[model samples]
Target: MTGDERTTTVGQLPTPDRDRARLPATLTRVVWLLWALSLVVLGLRWWRGEGWELAGVVAVDGLTVVLWAAVTFFGGIVHSYARRYMAGSETIDRFFGRVFAFTLVVLVLVAAESLVLFWLAWLAMGLLMADLIGHVEGWPQARAAGALARRHFLASSALLGVALATLWWETGATTVSGVAATVDGASPLVVLVAAGALVVAAMVQSALLPFHTWLLSSMTAPTPASALMHAGFVNAGGILLVRFAPVVTVEPAVMLAVVLVGAASALGGKLLKTVQTDIKGTLGCSTVGQMGFMLMQAGLGFFAAAITHLILHGFYKAYQFLSSGSRVEHTAPNGTSDGGTTGPVGGAVVVLTAIAGGALFAALTGKGTALDTGLLLAGLVVLTVMHAAREVVRQSDVPAAVRYGAVPLVALPAIAVYATVYGAIEGLLVGLPAVDEHAALTPVHALVGVAFLLTYLAVDTGVYRRSRRLYVALLNAGQPARETLLTDTEDYNEY
Candidate 1:
């Protein structure tokens, strides 16, 4: 049985024969009362002016009520379930104790938020949210299960707290400009040094050679922790590079360095993933490669591409963790091969994708570049195909036509607006004497032309095929030389 199966079984065992022990009806009433109070608070917040101070207070107090309600409801369920499945001298008290501690932590978070420490508030939310999910369904305990859960949960929270605190302190001392000013006010030099440190740190955490062990050590963490790391935290390193894009662009040396690290991580990460047998291990390395892509985009000033990659990868990684049961359930070797199935609509993504591809082709070749009015027709085509195909692939009740067509159409206007703004900015920055509006359109045309070419190459034979094959090879290797270095280092040190 998988770890998940074992836990579920422990939670699911029927309540053993026992004299009817009924909890007071008053307790149930109180739980309902708290839930009602929370809703009322939420309504009042909406009714009142959205003042930051008032809203913050309402949010804090309201969330407290909500947390209390959640604890009462879920805590009761866990107690009964534990009583049924977990047999030992250690039963009811331990479960309540841990639950109580968790509730207290929630209370502390509320108070912190009231103080306007938004960053701390976010960190606390993330940590508590993970723990709540992990312990909501109580499992049987062989020995001190409650204690074990507390220790691990608290340790995870502590780690999160420390990391965030360090970040807050480090980022607090100096603004990006201040850092730059230190090196003769040269933004390039500042970005070079700062981004260099971030790149090194990111490489280490991403499990690049000589630092791959952390990924394995991290696997022992709960699945939620793993998910957060994969989806966001691990990518923070690369994201940091993007966040500093304004500075990096001015710093030629830094941009080149970013390119090198991104290339190496992308190559090395894919190779290492291929060799990793553990599910989470594979995820860690995959993140390394994904992060590399984002870093490369940053280096190349492709902010839109980096943002797109980040959002998509985040959801995908999180869904993978939540659905796969995180090595807890024993079914498939690779998590993807088993676990929860998406509804039927998920199965039809391929058809929708083909439609999208066709639309993309039409848009690129259509006449009148610069919003290319014909592309609207092309997008419509893509939308139609997606609508037809989404019937089987999308589980939403919303009409696939409305859903698929709406977002891209909205995006078109936004992209055009941004493009216009970009053109104006270029005109201002580089005053080409007597350059008319039509002449100013040159940059936009050139950019679109380049993008069109690259898109074609990505789909075309030769280069695209080689890139995919290389990506696959690297993903399988688990890091080209990291494994060998680890083994050799271990052997030599033992002597």
Candidate 2:
């Protein structure tokens, strides 16, 4: 069947054979249902303070159960969404099968106690996602995207393999739990090298900074595939780090380096997002920034917070990708936004609300403005609340009093909900050690913070718009590979 002969005329995605769709849809739905039921069972066990292990093969505890619940829940949501979204696609079953396989692999990854099993599951996930990335097999752009992603994923796998192999060699531990127990006995040099490999592997998988092109170029994936990849797959990095927190935190310098790398990626991702012209590209950049921030939290000795960050991020990104189509209709004419002005009264309200939000966060989460990473976390909470307050005040049409009142009403509740979730996640992740570490504030942190703030201010104030060289550089960096570009419809039609 040719592209022009298909029934789906709604978007750029290919159409399916209607008759064949039901089989895959039904099979996927069945699996999703079973997966969801398993989550319930796991939750019950967790509530009862029970855990399980399979004699050094697999384990189900706080970390495993939480990740299982998260991945399967997202998988179920994607499967349900795709049943309708992919109804008329020819390879609907194939897509569903691959997605089903990927979800299972992730479940295994989270549960695997054996290092070899965990590594294999991790490797298989990338291969499955690469296949999904090129689900539109006839499209050369899609094929190129899949190939690029495959290469990056392969490299990520190789790094992870090397890290795990080194740990096994040094610690003589065949299982991840065993490695953690004996990792300290390994030489410092060996541990440092292995930890570095793990960080690189995670960065590649999460599409952080220099490794981000693969994800950005993967726009050719079906929307459902994109949603699953962004929601669940990219989150593996944070999970990897969290699971191996013992190795990562062996040296304070290594953790500091993670913070530096994460901060750089976070800043870079946000900057690059501003120059993206496409919706998927922009969202890809946003994922990079979010993943970077998650890693930063991990580096700060907040593994539980990192897990919470990824779980919430998965929910948010999945919705964004699935509903990206609606964004077109709602887009303002000529790309204009509601950017009126703010008055002095509204400005004062912003400052007050931000402070209150910060206080509320500290009180609720037990992370106050101390001489540690808690200060950084508190500052982020303040900025988030301030941004929320700013948006409310930006509504020029609303009365000053209403806008002022609405700021706290919106921001406080959000802060409260987030703090509550953070606490719950911390409790659920108690089985894993090193979930929360407070790094003492250093001069380097202060310097980096100042630089990040200045860069943010410059970008927000449109200072970069005047710099042609910087803008062009960023634009080029933000673009997908040349082979992945679909300049004309004929490119796909040629197949």
Q: Name the best candidate (by lDDT).
A: 2
lDDT (0 to 1) per candidate = 0.42, 0.85
Candidate 1, 309-406: lDDT as tens digits: 55456667766765554355565556542122324444345344645444454444331234532332234334434433433334355655564465
Supply the TM-score for candidate 1: 0.41
Clash tally, candidates in order: 22, 6
Measured over all alpha carbons after superposition, the RMSD of each candidate to the real structure, in angstroms, is 13.3, 3.0
- Show where candidate 1 strays beyond 4 Å: 1-173, 176-184, 187-191, 205-213, 275-278, 326-495
State the lDDT of candidate 2 residue by residue for 86-199, as single tens digits. 776667788888998888899899999999999999999999999999998668789999999999999999999999999998999998889888987899999999999999
TM-score of each: 0.41, 0.93
